[model samples]
Target chain A: MSTKHTIAVLVNDQPGVLQRVSGLFGRRGFNIESITVGQSEEAGLSRMVIVTTGDETTLEQVEKQLYKLIDVIKVINLSSKPMVARELALIKVKAEPSARPEIMGVVETFRASVVDIGTANMMVQVVGDTVKIDAMIELLKPYGIQELSRTGVTAMIRGNA
Target chain B: MSAQTPEVRSTEQLREKWLKPEVITGSEILLRSLLLEGVECVFGYPGGAVLYIYDAMYGFEDFNHVLTRHEQGAIHAADGYARASGKVGVCIATSGPGATNLVTGIATAYMDSVPLVVITGNVATTLIGTDAFQEADITGITMPITKHSYLVRDVKDLPRVIHEAFHIASTGRKGPVLIDVPKDVSAATTLFQPDDRIQLRGYNPRTVPNKLQLDKLARAIEEAERPMILAGGGVIYSGAHEGLYEFVNKSGIPITTTLLGLGAFPSGHDLWTGMPGMHGTYTSNHGIQQSDLLINIGARFDDRVTGKLDGFAPHAKIVHIDIDPAEIGKNVPTDIPIVGDVKTVLEMLNPIVPYAAKADAWRDQISKWKAEYPFRYVDSETVLKPQWVIEMLNDTTKGEAIVTTDVGQHQMWAAQYYKFNQPRSWITSGGLGTMGFGFPSAIGAQMAHPDRLVISINGDGGMQMCSQELAICAINNIPVKIVVINNQVLGMVRQWQELIYDNRYSHIDLAGSPDFVKLAEAYGVKGLRATTKEEAQRAWAEALETPGPVLVEFVVEKGENVYPMVTQGSTIDQMLMGDA
Candidate 1:
């Protein structure tokens, strides 16, 4: 089953690194769940946060394969380690005057913020594990949810600078 | 007084003993080691910087040199050889221009996951980076394409490094490895003893699947109501055809192949739904779309297969199995992921995957789709269709031949028409789509499987690109068959341009070309031609019966294109036949 795990990969930002990495997974018929890239601390290097899950052996193979690529410097499986894992979800829920207080009470319990509001619905933003987000959505379902969007898990290791 | 005169009575030596250096020059050591590692040939062109190595090659007589038309051809030839032979194919090129020319081939190999060892000569250390003639930083340029590469600064490292290169190239999700030799390094001598053991810190390859994950996968497969197996090329790479067959049979699931996965299952089998995706069989595409649980085994979900990503298999849950983890969720969302060699994963799942009767209903539905929408090629008139030529070749060979094809309509037709009963028998550039891969790959396949007949089914445009390599087959007694489908144009691209681009005729139509028969005769290979179905059958029979390499050109109808084509962004249900 798909488990959202964050892996930090360091690669030389060459012309075809993305294609090479994506092609490797594609060739093996593994679909990468999600990935995000940005400049890393090292010079001429970039860090990519890849959220993907496979069997333990396959995940190790993926790390090994990534290292085989000329541009890849390192791969760290963040999910298996003690790390900070979180995701941001923005959900719009419909509520009448009678359900507004209950919605506020649910939002306060989860420490969620009201990002936007209309006459019929209120958009709430919450950051937590997938289970927590799902729980909050389930609670809001009785009041009628309008829309939901999630920035799938983005995580990093907790450490000192 | 005689003792005092010292007439060479020594403490240790009275007779000469062979020096380790004399037992092998560095290049000779490299060549012999590669041969012992099962490299029967090297595709290359000799040049100044690597003269000593080329000369050393003469001492290793068992190793043949495939003189390619260009350095790029050498690399691609090696790529084809690796793909066809299921072994690491070696290629040698000189420095600078030769090395630079190999880049595209290396990239192609890298993209397609071919096992290749590319050896290139380097300018001497003293002249390095001085803008010397015939010098370039190949190791740097090829860094991205190779699995791993080395710049041998000293001759002593050549023997061990070459062995390691071979090991690394053929092992663990195989890809190309490069060994760059400086001119002086090849000339310098050292005690040469090739190490059989390689101790790389980070290169351990695991072949076994995680037991826990296997259990999970088994449960998923057992519970899946509409299970479909999407087998890909990795099955052949793993040599796990038997495992795949056993798992699919025991589990009683329908199997479909990607273009690269054509031979993973027996082509003519009932369970084998031809290829799936755009241009895929109706049953295969429908099977994928309607499947509740898709068991993707070593098959990449290419864009061609998934026409509109949003609408692809929308209701299906994917159980993806691959050796590489990066592929787990690269494109489609996977509900269950198993990472291990396909063969290993399949083996683990074989016992646990219950023989469910649920897939029977799905199979029955798919069979109806298959019967309703069978792949067709019309021999409506006197002109010979390329598909008929392919089917005739298949008939002549009895599906026991190693078939290689270049890129284009002929390639697609061959994929559709030919019935491959064996694994690793059908070789084509599925991922990279390189045009001139057929002839050289056929030569290599023939060399590897001497008793089996090897045939190159190529397009006219593709044939023209690598026709020069046909000289190598004639020079050496490599008995391979070349079947050129001469349609007088870049048929696939031309068809697309014609259909979608308002029939704007560009430089794609090659109206007149050198007489193919005369051309083949010039290279000392027998030439055969066919303009009709009977003539094509006779030509194929004659070519198959021929003792040595022969070129047979089937003058197919011009402007002909492959049908059942799912136009770009079109769903499988919307496939356009030729009449469209």
Candidate 2:
């Protein structure tokens, strides 16, 4: 019965606002799959894109509960309609001289870029949907990924109409 | 004159500062804000962190300030005052232990939707986060419990924060709001620019119900054969009882109430069918089970009311109305949800709906059930019962007393036995079910209505929770009749253990509990004890006649259980009615 939902919340950019939003989720026991916050188009507001997994009831409750918070201004379920979602990841993988060519081929195929190359290690940066970044990570796993860091999903609805 | 009196100095200062804004300390600003809001009384305890706030109240005779024995009593008293007075009650406490002590009481008020403005003094702003003495993150701690909270760092923001706290607390859904003022802020002086304007972009509450939803509800009411009205605390809170009365009488729909909704509809009305859900009347519960349309006003369908979500009102198309949108469909599925003020919505609906003579059969069936299963208890010459105590109080006061109750069997009995005909007459910790809420809140209710008789019903275990409040009651001459149902145990939990836990009673016993009679006398209040039913009646009579506060310990049936109970996960129709 549970499904993933991406909610875009616009909130006042005040001190302790992030903690208030995150703390609300923590107390309500709503598991956050992924969340990212950044400045919005408005001057005094920030947009938070949160990916959460829940059933229909949970989704409704989550949205209603978020509206109860003082700092929260607006909430939109981007995943409910046509929307664009993306995530970025930088993966550091072990690349030998011989393995570099194959790694470059994988990067080119995935449309990812090799940001930096060292003697024994190289970093690949990928920016796309979560599935795309996940696929690239899976490919780099066999080449021995040393470290990986991911910026969680951020989304907005399509066709402002 | 060597020194000008306060009145003279104030007059001179006003003349001198006529051209400019008056400057005052944050503590003074807070007090002035309360006065502007027409606050009459404040309950608090002074501490090291709140010395400045206390100093501001010293000999300041503009309003009354009650110095309670503990912070918990202070908060509950404020909550009680709010409920009975139908005005926002204010409370003050210092930081750390003082602030933490108010947590339970604050949560109690929040749960029951009592409007309260709670003020707490924190350690100096500079000393905050340094583990300073008597310091606490009260704003952070109470965030979940309170409707809103503020930790004021700047002195200039005091007026706005206090004003906003009151506005937010008293409006919309009505809940407690805390303002944690740092010691430095309270002591620091600033030019007072009082702004009554509330322009919070994200904090507006919707009061006008959507016409579409109202029309849908109207249509449902006209079409449905078995329509019923389930009123909640919001009816009393919004002062919509008169309108609700009109709606019920106009539509010819039978009405039931939640515990907090006991006083919203007159108990003696022909259309009234007692409370609904767990421990409610068989007529209301079974009637809800069969109703085709359930029109709920102001009451959230809490699990206690709904029992099993899947089994609750399976046949009914619910029309949920509340001021808070989050509560509409939070628990049970709502067919027609109207988010608005109950009073406003009822006014809008009164003229639109026609008389429903179709529900005559449904009403007749409910009346039959009510007659068949009345709230009855067996009488004994030797044994005293809690229900009898409540019934006697109802008779003795002619149901004119404002009844507040502590959580447990006695509270349920009070809700069941006491017949309230007026709104705001029944105040209890229904949401939080706080044990120590009764006595202090009774103090508050008595303070609000000096002419009305106020009775605080408590169990043995809960009596000890905040019995220290007796000092204030005696000193202030609150005249609250404190009824202690001394079965010498936690009756509700013990009953649950007896039924659900195979009689393996945990530490529900209160054998070492103090003799409540001596305890009251120690605090300079009258005390009485009753071991037999006759003695209880006599003691009740004496207490009612006595001048000041009275604590009557009525020894009740030890192993008794409140029947008509719908256990957890059970449907309302499936009640455990123990053999009478």
Candidate 1, residue A2: Cα displacement in angstroms equals 20
Instruction: Tell me the TM-score of model 1.
Output: 0.79
lDDT by residue (B1-580, candidate 1, tens digit) is 0112334433234211211335556776776667667666788998988888898876444556777778876777787678777988889999999899888778878767788999999999788889898999887777667787888887888878888888888877778998889899888876667567876644666668778877777777677788888988889988888998898788888889888888789977777889887677878888888888888898778787777777788667888887766666767778787777887777777878777566777778877887787788667468988888888888777888889999899999898888887887888887778888787778777766878888889898988877888787788767889999999999998989888899997789777888898899999999999998888888878887889999999998887778777788766656676762
Clash-forming residue pairs, model 1 = A30-B327, A30-B328, A31-B327, A31-B328, A31-B329, A31-B330, A32-B329, A32-B330, A33-B329
Distance from true position, residue B297, model 2, in Å?
0.7
Q: In model 1 chain B, which range of ten residues has the least summed lDDT?
A: B11-20
TM-scores for candidates 1 onward, in order: 0.79, 0.96
Strongest candidate by DockQ? 2
Q: Across residues A96-156, which tens digit of lDDT does each residue of candidate 1 receive?
A: 7677888999999999988988888899999997789989989988888889998776668
Off by over 4 Å in 1: A1-65, A70-74, A77-161, B1-24
Specify the highest-TM-score model's number.
2
Cα RMSD for predicted model 2: 3.0
Question: Model 2 over residues B415-529: C-alpha lDDT tens digits?
Answer: 9999999999999998889999999999999889989899999998888999999999988888999999989899999999999999999999898999899999999999999
